[model samples]
Target chain A: MILVNENTRVVVQGITGREGGFHAERCMAYGTQIVAGVTPGRGGTLWQDKVPVFDTMEQAVRETGANCSLIFVPAPFATDAILEAVDAGIGVIACITEGIPVQESVKVYSYLKDKRVHLIGPNCPGLISPGARCKVGIMPGDIHRPGTIGVVSRSGTLTYEAVAQLTEAGLGQSTCVGIGGDPVTGTDFVDILKLFNKDPDTEGVVLIGEIGGAKEQEAARYIKRSFKKPVVALVVGATAPPGKRMGHAGAIITGVSGRAEEKIRALREAGATIVPSPGEIGVTMKRALRR
Target chain B: MKIHEHQAKAIFARYGIPVPEGGVASTPQEAREIAQRLGGRVVVKAQVHAGGRGRAGGIKVVDSPEAAQQAAVALLGKHLVTHQTGPEGVPVSKVLVEQVVPVERELYLAIVVDGSGKAPVIIGSEAGGMDIEEVAAIHPEKILQVRVDPIIGFQPYMGRDLAYAMHLPSAVVRNAATIIGNLHRVFIDEDATLAEINPLVLTPDGKLLALDGKLNLDDDAFFRHPTHQQLQDPEQEDPLEVEAGKYDISYVKLDGDVGCMVNGAGLAMATLDVINAAHAQPANFLDIGGGGDEAKVAQAFRLVVADPKVKRVFINVFGGILRCDVAARGIVQAYGELKTPMPIVVRMRGTNAEEGRQILNDSGIPVRLVADLKEAIAQLQQVGRR
Candidate 1:
């Protein structure tokens, strides 16, 4: 019942832009179904001579019956692009745009509360389901493989790190989601954890969290009460100095709450085995499952 | 970016939030003149990003202009070591001189983007002279938060809720509500991530004043507010970190031997953690972003090598949107020009890893290319032993 699968038809927002066009082509090459493209004022023009471009999301959805949107618009215009996709009644919206204003995200998030759309990122790598060969966002398509261990993280490259190590350890993934690193992002650990718990193909889960925010703590409580899948967690920025933003906007230590140590303690208490080192992520997941 | 207290107060004043009369002074004499102009009793505050200034001897309440001058002379040229500033204190070049306000009660108020809620939240507390965190840990019942709907903006009911919860008197209830509304307006108008008034004081004369203001404007929204962008102080940050920010590279200095330049922040911190687990500390945290081109790569290499503490460089790039070959080309170019014979452990994964590895192998630089993160960490540890 996870939103992404082989049957998911995708639309590319800002398909005419450099980053958007490049990634859109790559997503298609990786066997993701691309049905439509949207770029204001650049309608009627075909992208890569295959996908049809429309002036607005409404036209794109009406013409192609696209259910999912992969947004790669620049930061300044990303907020409008996300709201536009939501307005057009897209079910799954995954924004790959980085550096969007938090205030803009606030408006988009509040608007999405009443809507049926499941938004992914305002600054994230998006998600990939290897077994179904469905990829959305910017994760490297080759590093993933079809298997049972589900992965969720707050960072892009680190998500790749987990995938590579898991693949190397002979444990493939069902779906890997990067929930973005911004202070205000669409999807959080709890949202994706709930999805993974319901996915029949997913046997276990790997939660890669970091410092900043209480999302991981909340996810820990959810795992304790509802989730029964074996979870191996990793929280980075253990040695990070306070008040210093570690690349991701959300990966900062603000006083004593957003500390990596605190997150580790919470995850461990919730019956999730905490991997203190990145090198031990795959090995620990294998051990946690007794596979 | 974080703006100083004076700048925050200035923004707060413009938004009609009640603040003390103040002006920034670069010299002690200017501070004294400003103090005298503000009346006999004044407060001299060191303008720095870090907190706990009062305990750090950065804030002084003086009765006369001579006392203000003495406080400025003692603080202006000295480095203030606050609990928030870590071991290395920030250098003070300016002070904000303002008229002192007598307090009846100290309250705390702040507006911040609630990350989990994905909305702006207004936080207020009755117990507020101390750190908000302390108040939260010790007396959480005194604190209250209201998440505002961004579309409808900060509603009057929300302000009224806070006023009623904080137990504002009938006389200052409207004033407190207006301050809350204006604070939220400034948060939206200025595109600030955090706008706080610690010790939103209730004066002895029955008036609420924002005694201490702190505002952090979102860097992503800097283009919209050019005036807020100008408030950034490069002098307040490490030179290398400031330089790295210009190129969209995130660099933080750490005391270690291995210098790490990774693709993303999460991976960068994990790389440092992995290296630390292998019994070696990372010298610096340098993330060239996900789309680091050859120019950014070369610049990152130069920045890493500039530090004398960095002995061996560990370059870990996960080629996702950034092709591994592009990273490889950058490494080769930096090594060729710099001619630094530092043993570099290059771990290139994801897309085009084979091509990236080939480029590095052909470069004939003393570089060790490892396939996995574990192997790379082990390799770095061995290099550290050597």
Candidate 2:
């Protein structure tokens, strides 16, 4: 019931591009229903001769009634594509495009304030609901299994690393969402945690955080007060140098605020189980679940 | 894309913000001439990307034009290394010549996107001319913050709030608000990631001027403003990093023996962490990203091998969007061309893992394939020993 499920009707923006075409096919293979595709220049064309392709998001939404928009547009044009999706009334939008300008993200984020929309990422791997067999964006589908734990992360492959470990421990996920490691992202940890809290399938939660930004600390505060589910966390880049962006744009420590130690202390004070290292997440999550 | 102080001041001046009359001089004679025009009392500041210029003697106050020339001669054509700049200092090509102002109080002002809040935040502090981070760490109450709602834009009320919080005198309250509003306008208008004035000084004559300025434009937004692309200084950047950027891959060279090439940034950092945990330092942090094709992988391999300090190469990839076989082919191609004697360890998982491993084995390139990060690190250590 959180974000995406089995009956999610998706529309792929920039469907004519390499990533959009490729990932749209992958999402379909993972049992997600992609109803339509939008590419401005190539309207009335059938994508792979299956999904109907329209010139505009409005046309696609009017035709297919797609509630979700999966964006694979390039970075520079991503802001407009996201706004188009929002304008066309997409309830949930997962933007897979990375390297969208921070200023553009600021504008898009501000625009989302008044709308009833949930945007996932401008640089994220998107989300997957294992039990419902619904996959959106770019995360590999095979590693996920339907179970009781919910996962949220600020990284791409690290999410897979933890999920693979959870699957190895015979623990499956209700849903996994990558909120993106960009400084400004659409969906926040608290927003996802709120959804997971309401989700009956989610018995436990795992947060995969990295160095940089105060999102993790804020999430810890929210968990201490509102959340009742058992939670465990793994924050990477504990040894990362200051003032250096650790690959992700948002994963850079600017001042004393966004350090890994600070986030760890806050999460610990909130009673969330802290995984000492990325390799220890599986064991730590199992211990947390038992408690 | 961090612009020099002179450039930032130019931008600030255009936004109707008060700035000292200054000119950028490429030579000592030019500095002297600019100082002569600005009047005898002037400051000659080295124009470099790194900060802490004053402490490094990169900044000097000159009582006469000859002193300004001597200061310029002492700075220009010399390497200026501050605490911020690494051991190999950045060369000073230019200097800013400006008239010195009478400072009554130095206040801090800037506009930056607060990542956690996902909005533009205006940060101002009473404790200025010092490291704002240290001020924020010691006395957080001194820092005044206002998160701007973009829909309403930067309102005058928000600026007033900041001015009041900073406890500015009633005489300069409106001026402070206007400056704060102008800074926010510059932040948005220039598509800047950061627009800051280190010492927005209030003159004894009740005039406010931006003493030092810094602006960092968003590189991703270069397409929107093509002219801003011209501001990039490749000479000031690491040659390897600049090369990697052409292929859309992120590369940061580190002083270690094992070169690491991974798929995602988080996983790349994790790979570095795992390598360090195994008592080995990483040669570099290179993320090929999720869109790695054969060419990108081959290029990434070339960059890794190009590092003379790299004795061994470790490739850790999680083949989700990027198929493992593509990476395998890239490695084989690069090894065939470079013919370097450096040992290579490969860790391939998900999406045609078996096929990728098979390709590596058949290449007969002596590429050792590991199953996961733990094995990859162990293999790296093992190869590092031999």
Candidate 3:
């Protein structure tokens, strides 16, 4: 159990908003421990007529002993929300908000360098551990199952696509994490891979990457040097054009480093089995695990 | 969002950076007047977002106002093709007329947010007036960078180190550092992702001036900078893309026939790759986003079919927050409104996928719903061959 498990008590930030309220209920329905809700003005109320709502993170943390934070705040105020959770001494934070400015993300990322806390995303689908029954994101909970393969990606629905295929192939996952598509994120492929490397239950890992930055290359270097498990890699955006942002803010080919071909080459050279297309992620991972 | 050189210079000037005396002119007469005001020795540069303007004959040096008018006439209201722009090129509606400087050396300076480093980095090089990518590839040692800690902010010593590394003259090194500091300030204050001064010229008089400027503002930070959002020039963008933007859709027009509409950015790109792998081309890249409602999906469908080159359509949705039923209903609604009969292939999975499949199957519309992505591609290819 990495990042989140059954014992992890969760706090829903911006719980009064439409996205926050909806996802909070779904996460609860998935059997996640919804400890408390935080909405500044809407304190002293009950969310879904069960969980308590607090005006501040400090109050929520003290009252509910919530160890993890799931943020669905809008982009403009999301930075402050993440900082609030950080200040409240939350052990784990997952921000599902999208479109946060890079400046704000960089600042938060810099601040978290020395902290022991783990921040998941500002523009991500979050993570889920089916075995632990701990869902802390907006991902569809049914597609995931408890198994040996650990999955991490830089996308949302794409992760779901890979997970659905894995489940159909009877390859369940230990944990599925989306580090986000933003240029700056709290956790990355290397961070999640480190956790998977140490977990005894995680037999193999599936790393999904795209056309942004050199994080994928860095991950490849890590896998080549230290990772103990067989790795399966998929780098998308082979047909994307240069200088054009492909949907994700970070999914643009700025220079030679951000090209998909370069990332795929690095991963392949690192001795990881590369999935040729998105549809092949499942069978590729299963084949790598069998070896 | 990329702003023209003139707009970038204006923004840089506000931050106390020294830019050459220049004015943007939309007409030949206006260019003549601006050139005359600048002592009649000016450089008429086409104001387009694409680069390689000098090699593309988009830039010309003229010594007289009459010649400046002629240069503007040759550039403005014409498509200036460059290596950055496609072969068709972009329309140049304006020209920047600036006083020509006597340059002794050209340097490059820029502040870009390093995605891997997770901070802003100051990049400086002695090699300038050419593509930085080429310089980076050929002489990687020439590119010197200093990472600025976002928590500590941009420090003077960081800029000083970059300027010193560029090996500037002692007389102008401090001034160059100051300009770098100012550029960093502009980058932070304007929410700009990229702020660059290519060919930061050093004149015989020991003065440093920004000969060219380029700034790319962060579209995600538009809520904070409403004025910067107004700087968007729709004429420089594809009309279909501009239309997609109004409905909060992410779209980019490409040269292909299979129109692709997907729910996520990563999935959308993979769809394009899948189409190409099937020996077909993707007309455009469109992402309806994570939380696509019925209306938004309808808008995305309309935009996809709007491209006349679209021979077939591929709708791939792995529904998470956006239920498959919603996407199917939206597609069915769009197909009715569009009333354009074309081969449509949909591959939907995850939440409420069965209901979505039923919605499309009962919509009285002919849609090829494939359970597997590979089968979907094969079916799409079969239709393309027909």
Candidate 4:
């Protein structure tokens, strides 16, 4: 069941920082084969949880055969950190930092050509494959159980909401990935959906999304084009006036075209049984199962 | 951050953009003195956060200095209701005392984000001093839009064309072009999302002057301009919503009894709508944002519970990217701290959902695990006596 298993060791970039240290400790606790932690000048030392530290991604990957890199570097340094991970031959790169400059994420994404690597997020919460026990983002460790529902979202908190609901509905997850909040994200929704589609264990899907980006529309198109399982969607920003910025800062979807109505219309048109409230996710999934 | 017209003018003047002489005062005596100093009939305008001050009697033409003082006295500390400032009304914090200009021709000019394009766009009209929304909806023909090229910057030809559209006198056209050019520079340089000049006027004497100015800077851009921080007018804003922004939670208080909690803004709003669709009212819309640690989630629960208006509770989150288990831990942690004595319906789904449910089930918290979004609403509906 492990497509990329324990041998694909992880190197934690910015291992000295708050998010990095916290998640690094959690991932190690979850039994991820963590090879090394990367924090410049913190090399030759050990993380509080006793993971060996290295000065750079190159050194860590070179020395320990760490092919998967999880970056918790702050915004300004995130660009360089992801690139270093990619350049260091990391097969999978998860940048778990929010507020990464959009332009920087784009440049890094654009530069990823010819490299057979998967980039998850520059603003995402990272991914978790249950029972494997490795967590590379801020998602808590207590709620996961190895089950069949595959989860993907443009939101971090909403992802938790859907997961909780699915578990209560007696559905478990194969993998949960936070695609992040940035407008220009590293992975498209379809990319993760495809992964779930291929996983035999993932029977159904719960996709939590918000208004603004064309990402949901693209997901809708992908669903209509290929996906067969009953997909439940929770699209946020209803009654939220389009084009006015909020706490996500400048994220606003305005006018007749980008409003919640249009996105919901597309989602519904694509055969997604839309769950109006995140609170109803469990109930809705139960209903979906019965159908 | 929003500053008054006079303050905006002061800021604009520093950037070498020509503005008509104006002074702000909180007292009647100060208004009279400013009017006398200007040596002309004055415009007494209430300093509030809304438009339509001219039609609402908030703005008055005072022929004499004494009349200016009387008008200032009447306007000071008074609440001026306008369409933009909402029902609570914008409080008259001060009075703008300015020389009355004789207008031969008027033009409207503004720079705001094109909500459709997600770009800063310049809007200009031959008709000045009008409600922009009305102008946009009605006489859109008069409104000339110029897209500021992010790369090459605002072209000189765009300014010249916009100036020509205003049909200013030859001497004033050059001045108008300079103002438009400077406005573009100011907009990009300041990281402003909206910079408007209402009644950008041509006086009968053939001088071009900016009668009023308004600028709304990008909140994210405020980090770069520390000195330009302005106080939010609470009377013109939502207190709970404003307070929530400080805690990094996007919260909007609603008239519903079911207090709803979710992790994404879009999801939160959808939750509210679903609550409504089920004929249940949502008490509040709360998003815990992307940083979903136990503390942040705990705080989100705390905020939901804080609302006395809320009767039953609906907790929903989709941990598609967030681990379902982490969310469960956060829920258990918060439920432990408060004992959350209220009847709670929780629907958490996505990755690690099964494990997350096990964590919650083990927590011994008296929380209902709803089957989905609608059933949770239906359950909340049954419990709501309100």
Best by DockQ: 3
lDDT of 2 by residue, B82-180 (tens): 998777788899999999999999999988999877789999998989989989889889998899976678999898888888888888889989999
Model 1 chain B: weakest 10-residue lDDT segment is B332-341
TM-score of 2: 0.96
Off by over 4 Å in 2: B337-340
Give the DockQ-based CAPRI class for model 3: high
lDDT of 3 by residue, B1-386 (tens): 99999999999899999999989999999999999999999999999999999999999999999999999999999998999887889999999999999999999999999988999999999998878999999989999999998978888888788888888888888899899999999999999899999989999999999999999999999999989888899988889999999998999999999999999998998888888889888999999987789999989999999999998999998888788999999999999976568999999898889999999999988799999779987998889988
Of the true contacts between chains A and B, what fraction does model 4 have? 0.27
Two-chain DockQ for each candidate model: 0.77, 0.69, 0.84, 0.22
Question: TM-score for chain A of every candidate model?
Answer: 0.98, 0.98, 0.99, 0.93
Q: Candidate 1: where are CA atoms >4 Å away?
A: B337-340
Number of the top candidate by TM-score? Answer: 3
lDDT of 4: 0.74
DockQ score of candidate 2?
0.69
CA lDDT scores, all candidates in order: 0.89, 0.89, 0.92, 0.74
Clashing pairs in 3: none
Error (Å) of candidate 3 at residue B47 is: 0.7
**Candidate 4 lDDT tens digits, B246-306:** 7777776666688888876656766777777778778887877765676677777777777
Error of 1 at A173 (Å): 2.0
Q: Can you write out model 3's per-residue Cα lDDT over A1-291, one digit (the tens) per residue?
A: 588888899999999899999999999999999999999999999988999999999999999999999999999999999999999999989999999999999999999868989999879998899998899999999998998889999988889889998998899989999999999999988999999999998999989999979999999999999999999998999999899999999999998989999999999999999998788989998888788
Looking at model 4, give its docking quality level.
Answer: incorrect
lDDT for position A270 in model 2: 93
Model 1 docking tier (incorrect/acceptable/medium/high): medium
lDDT tens readout by residue for model 1, B142-251: 99999987888888888888988998787888889999999999999999888999989999799889999999989999778877778998878878889898888999
